[model samples]
Target: MDVKIDSEGAFGSAIVTLEAGEKFVSEAGAMHRASPNMDINVESRRKKMKVYGVHLSLSESNVCR
Candidate 1:
């Protein structure tokens, strides 16, 4: 796996090259670009939890909130 960072700053983008069977997990919309061989799965964390009758929402204690 090769990780290449383009530019520099909080708003900088990243280009990742993954070998066969490599897996990469990142925050929502974090991936700027990827190779065609890579398999991309975008999941909604809060939505997936709701399937089991679990509800997750913003909280003051959590920075992501």
Candidate 2:
């Protein structure tokens, strides 16, 4: 999960570049601290069929919310 973000800041002066995996881990940690119920599951996909269901749930949440 390599992450690269390109965006102008409020002042539009500084450029920020962050690794996606690093950001997700950092955010997941903070979110976990604030709300103890959301379990951030980081799993390497072993099979397509096995992960399809999990991916569907995550995708649905992304759109429905």
Candidate 3:
């Protein structure tokens, strides 16, 4: 797999190229576009998280392709 990140000012985007049988994983809602030949799957999980001394329950989504 090959990845590139492009940014201008405060905005940025990632471009990824994947070979056969290769997969990419990323946080859900992070992908704006993908090639038509690629297959995409989404998985969600609930877990406990803590930040800044605060406890939180979060549902996380992962995208795999």
Candidate 4:
């Protein structure tokens, strides 16, 4: 799924393109409006068997600031 957070850095809209054989059974949403500093929750169909590093992909707004 591709989601773009709003310009206000609050809520976001997403274009979920699931894998052909995969399905999104359920989802939980909250904080329709929130700032950039808000905590973000992430999920995946599979569990992490080992610790992985995080990659930073900052947008122009957040990066340039």
In terms of lDDT, the best-performing candidate is 3
Candidate 2 lDDT, tens digit per residue, 1-65? 33334345752322222222222333211221212223345544546555321111122223322
lDDT of 2 at 36: 27
- Candidate 1, residue 63: how far the Cα is off, in Å: 38
Candidate 3 local lDDT, 8-41, one digit each (tens): 4555787877666666766555677765666666
Candidate 2 RMSD to the real structure = 12.3
List residue ranges in candidate 3 displaced over 4 A.
50-65
Comparing 3 and 4 on TM-score, the stronger one = 3
lDDT for each candidate structure: 0.51, 0.30, 0.55, 0.35
Comparing 1 and 2 on lDDT, the stronger one: 1
Worst 10 residues of 3 by lDDT: 50-59
User: Sorted on TM-score, highest at the top, how do the candidates line up?
Assistant: 3, 1, 4, 2
The C-alpha local distance difference test score for the whole of candidate 3 amounts to: 0.55
Q: What pairs collide in candidate 4?
A: none
Q: Which residues of candidate 1, in runs, are more than 4 Å off?
A: 46-65
Writing each residue's lDDT as its tens digit, candidate 1 over 1-65 gives 56687777979876665444555667665655554434455555555454222112222333221
Q: What's the lDDT for residue 3 in model 2?
A: 32
